[model samples]
Target: MRIYKVGGAVRDRLLGKPVTDIDWVVVGATTEEMLAKGFRPVGADFPVFLHPNSGEEYALARTERKSGRGYGGFTFHASPEVTLEEDLIRRDLTINAMAEDDQQNLTDPYHGQRDLEARLLRHVSPAFAEDPLRVLRVARFAARYAALGFTVAPETLELMRQLSESGELEALTPERSWKEISRALMENQPQVFIEVLRACGALKVLMPEVDALFGVPQPPAHHPEIDTGVHTLSVLQQAALHKQPLTVRWACLLHDLGKGLTPEQEWPQHIAHEFKGLKLIKAVNERFKAPRDCQELAMLVGEYHTHGHRALELKPSTLLELLQSFDVYRRPQRFEEFIAACEMDARGREGLEQRSYPQADYLRGAATAARTIAVQPLLEKGFKGPELGEAIKRERLKALKAYKENA
Candidate 1:
């Protein structure tokens, strides 16, 4: 059996990136031979094993045939007869189909090296259309490598569009779709992932709520970009540029879903859109099975992002209520995420990206001032039960009033 380093390990290495994990493909090897050599069997669908010492994944070279629909409907064939070329050809991207030997020699039958040099993300073969997940995967790769100037080849994009048109993209399971989405959100250019998906028509299938935002108009006075969809993308880009956490990024993406539901008569004005967006955010969260933290933050951002922008003008009582609503006393970090998300929203407008967002600091100070109202002090004053809670609220309101006045 000949062992070769394959897939992402080889691809990242050639890009001068730090390779975190290495995958191996064993050519001319059988399951019996692998087991005889102390490799522990791991895969159920195919002959994948864990090397006894290195503990890295090593799979017997295998070829797959499409037997059904979706990504999981493939039947795999593995044996000594499966050539390395056949194994490589099954990969989704040419840049990921190359292999390396122990002596560091390259085995690039698919011209993956040439594609990598050209900064292209091309498909390995037409079989790319068989697995719908590759469409999301390629978009994710575009997000990951966008700063490096890598783009999907036009023919590959056409194949992705075909997959979308074929309805196979809808066949992707929620968990699988979220896996790609969450990873893409954390990439350097997460907005590019959204753009790519939109270009390939996958966005409309996977996230119709988001897709509907494209032509929806917003008040130009508040959003110079006018298009709610463009503003959303800009907000997402700002989140990534600021290195905000995943929860913040996700909140930015869904903050304006309500705008898409505005009545035609209300074209540029979406009164109460903040609260209107709550259900849409919940729907998206339920669809993706998003993390509780992400969903909660998105919901809060959707319901109260405008409140953040109005912080400076809001009554002290309103500021206290906003702080309490966010549970800032116990979950301050999530409140901070809320501020960051709202800042992204305000900054996402055209000609406003570099403008300062004083609302963030205003809310932060209000939170700090409210937090300073000690419960122990209320208890020390012999306030009890409802009276104590009421006293604490009163004290917090007083502190926030003074804080806002000082600002």
Candidate 2:
């Protein structure tokens, strides 16, 4: 059997990047031979093993035939007869199909090195259309390498569009779809992920609520970009530009789903859109089964981002109510994420990206002032049970009132 480093480890190494994960392909190897050599079986669908000492994944060279639909419908064939070239051809991208030997020699039968130098993301073969998940995977790779000037080959994009149009995207499990989405959101250029998905038509199938935002108008006096879809992507870009966490990024992506529901006659005006967006956001949250922290934060931001933008003008009571709605006292970090999402919204407008968002500071100051109200002092004054709770609330409001006046 011959072993060679393959896939991402080889790709990233050529790009002068730090490789964190390594995968190996064992050519001319059988399951019996692997087991005889102390390799532990791991892969359920194929002969993938964990090297006994290095503990890294070493998959037997295998070929696949499409037997059904979605990403899980493939039948794999593995044996000594499966050539390394055959296994490499099944990869999603040419840039990921190269391999490296122990002596650091390269085995690049697919011209992956040439594509790397050209800054291209091309498919390994037409078989790329068989697996629906490759659409998301390619979109994610586009997001990851966007800053490096990589663009998907036009043919690859056409294939992605065909795959999306085939309705295979809808066949994917929610958990699988969300895994790609969350990872793409955390990439250096999260907005590119959205743009690539939209370009390939996958966005419309996987996230129709988001897809409907395109061509929708917003009040141009505030949004020079004019399109709600453009604004949403810009907001997502801002979240990534500043390295905001996934909760903030998720909120930014869906903050304006309600705008898509506005009547055309009401075009530029989306009165009460904030409240209208809550149900759509909840649907998305339920669909993906997003983590509780991500779900709760996205919901709070979607419903109250308007409040965050208008913090300076809100009454002290309104500010206190907003803080309470976010459970600021119990979960201050989530509140901060809400503020960050609001800031992303404000700066996401065209030509307004560099503008300062005082509302963020204003809300943060109000939260700080209200949260510092001490309940122990009220308890010492003999307030009891529900009365003590009411007294604490009153004190928090008083503190916020004072803070507003000072500002």
Candidate number with greatest lDDT? 1
- Name the runs in model 1 displaced over 4 angstroms: none
What is the RMSD of candidate 1? 1.3
Of candidate 1, the 10-residue stretch with the lowest lDDT total is 372-381
> lDDT per residue, candidate 2, 143-219, as tens digits?
99999999999999999999999988888888998999999999999889989999999999888899999999999
lDDT of 1 by residue, 276-376 (tens): 88999999999999999999999999999999999899999888889989999999999999999999999899999999999988888989999988788
TM per model?
A: 0.97, 0.98
- Candidate 2 clash pair list: none
Q: How much is 301 displaced in model 2, in angstroms?
A: 0.7
